[model samples]
Target: MEKKRYYNDNIGPIKENEVLALKKALELCNEIGDITQITLLIHTKGNTGYLERIFETRNLKDFFRGVKIDQNYPPLKIETVRTFNDDWQGKKIVVAFGLRSNELHKYDDYENVAGIIAHQWSEDSVKDWAQSWGAIDLKTETEIEKTALPDKVVQQAFIDLTNSINMTTGITHPMDEEQCKTYIRALKKYDYELNSKEIFSFLTTELNWESDNANDVIKLIDKVNSGGYFKGGAKTGLQHHIKRWKSK
Candidate 1:
């Protein structure tokens, strides 16, 4: 099955005010060790105002050394390089976003950046998928660096969070042996194939528990136990399985 596209361009045209905010984003990136360099190439539609307009951006001019402003194209483009994998080791992963698009995009993947390379590229749509699923949107050199806690981390995080919910509320989401087995199999193929949003959908209607929050693994366990947040005197504390895995 084809993966769903993560974003749609419903927002209006881009504004210089918004681009100005890129300074703050750049600062944040530097703080997070997200980027070490900036290479600017401006292609502007034929406008005499373009030259002065480009130079007027005080914030962008200060940080970047390669500011090439052109009056021959559409909206401006921004790209970055950041570290991504063991193969490239310390290479940059390149993410690009254009003035026409409202969001940045990444194209880094193991299959794409699995060798001696300088950068990995990803599109805005793929970045959308990751962000929609709760992953950080860092369109740097490493494709997966902007992680929603890669599988191992997610698994361990899941365990900790679920465990905490159990202890605090004395409620546990019970999963039958078979359900757990099936879930593990799914995880092997798709740790993020299903996300909190998808899993939570099941909780609200199908489970008949009337919950707005759920997880594929934890929800299964919840159904098995039938011990719940409402019964435990907690409305949103329906996170037993996830919280439990977190404390350790």
Candidate 2:
């Protein structure tokens, strides 16, 4: 994800390369694991006609939610490029979000789908029928604060954390106690990262959501277990968890 990324899909004229890009990302997602579902959004009504054909090229036939995000709100167009590290069900998906090349570029790079994708993806726990969507998008710390995880994110986080159990030391970016509290408190407030410090905190803390990378998270849990800053002993973890939440 460190590398600058770009995404462009032909929502109107239906460019072959755009379809190819989408197909490649979807195929990669399934190869990594079971793709329970996929949401497809088309930028234009014209592209809606192309949805069936796009999915027909592969098994991602169901994960499409077509939308004209660029029509109403131009800001969403920027999100087209921010698909480098999207995490769904704890797995980083190999997809890129984008509009057509003709679309305007708001940022220098054009990637910005993190926050929007989180909003659209969801999960339903109706018996064994329960399923989640959008595992291919990285939800930023600032973005995570804005979302109400459908147990999708948390369940994904749990699986993500469990899969990564090497248990190593996790060094949190330096933040004053007050800053940490504020960061945690942001969970309750939408648009929390509007504060400049939160952006810095996110950078320093490594994209929040407590390091979704399996190795990184496992080491973090390990560090906490090994007594990074807990008061008592192992039990202190549960206690700390409690205090962190209750104190809020």
Residue 227 local lDDT, model 2: 44
Query: Which candidate wins on lDDT?
Result: 1
All models, RMSD in angstroms: 15.8, 16.6
Poorly placed runs, candidate 1 (over 4 Å)? 1-10, 39-95, 98-127, 133-248
* RMSD, candidate 2, Å: 16.6
TM-score of 1: 0.26
Q: Tell me how candidate 1 scores on lDDT.
A: 0.31
> For model 2, what is the C-alpha lDDT against the true structure?
0.29
- What's the distance in Å from true for residue 202, model 1? 16
TM-score list, all predictions:
0.26, 0.26
Candidate 2 lDDT tens digits, 79-150: 123322233333222232333211211121222222112111112111111111112222221211222232
